[model samples]
Target: MKAKYLVLSFFFFTAGTLFSQNKSVPKSIIKQNASILKFYDKKELQSMQKGQLLVLYVERTKTLIKTLPYIALASKPGVTMVDLGIPFTSENISLLDTQHDATDKFLDITTEFQKGMLPYSDKESLIKAILFYESVLKQMHELNEQE
Candidate 1:
């Protein structure tokens, strides 16, 4: 009899504690069905955002590429050019190196994307892609903002 009573008391105490721990959320903030999120689950929504950022990055890179001079392409094949004694300072060399690195990184990402190297499933590949895309997008945003 004592054991049964003790078990009942412990059950009631646990139930009461659990019930108290659950805080009530205000009804006003909770929508029955938000149309904006009607179709997309959290992962899909995140993937969509990453896709948008990639598109933006591609667009910006395209613009940048356009603005760059195509001097090498314009030059005739087997043509030897005389040195103009162009001065290359350390700072200028480093700046050009950094620019080339950024362009190469962007090209690498786009090439991988075009090859369908990133699997869009809710698996490890997709998660890693999402993180990579997010970081790239963040870097682009910061550079744009600075400019």
Candidate 2:
């Protein structure tokens, strides 16, 4: 009986340890995160005019707004937006409409994102969409300072 109890305890402990291990983040997500960091450099964004950034932001946000629901539905649960190496948050998303005429569209994207939408089919596309959003926000801030 003592030997049987020891075996059972060992089995349970080993099983729990195996099951509780943290799953590794996918290589694609890591690569996408790196790409986003490189693409949205602060100096580069500061140099771009607000109009250019606005146009890019509006177009990419529109695409994300349209496709994010599908991506969210198809993706596994617990998948999240790749880290963009910036302070992207719900508040930042809400502020997207403050500088643009497409307020409704921006609001739509923010709502979808808040609802856990993943924004694109692949990591690369998602990275581009987020980078554009970040760049536009930076440019908008610069423009506001100038005004």
Clashes of each: 0, 0
TM-score of each: 0.26, 0.26
Tell me the whole-model lDDT of each prediction, alpha carbons only. 0.42, 0.44
Best model per lDDT = 2
lDDT of 1: 0.42
lDDT of 2: 0.44
Superposed model 2: Cα runs more than 4 Å off: 1-38, 74-147
lDDT of 1 by residue, 1-147 (tens): 999999999999999988884322212111122111122233653556545534433443443342233232211112111122323445544554565567667667775674474234344444454445444434433542452
Which regions of candidate 1 deviate over 4 angstroms? 1-84, 117-147
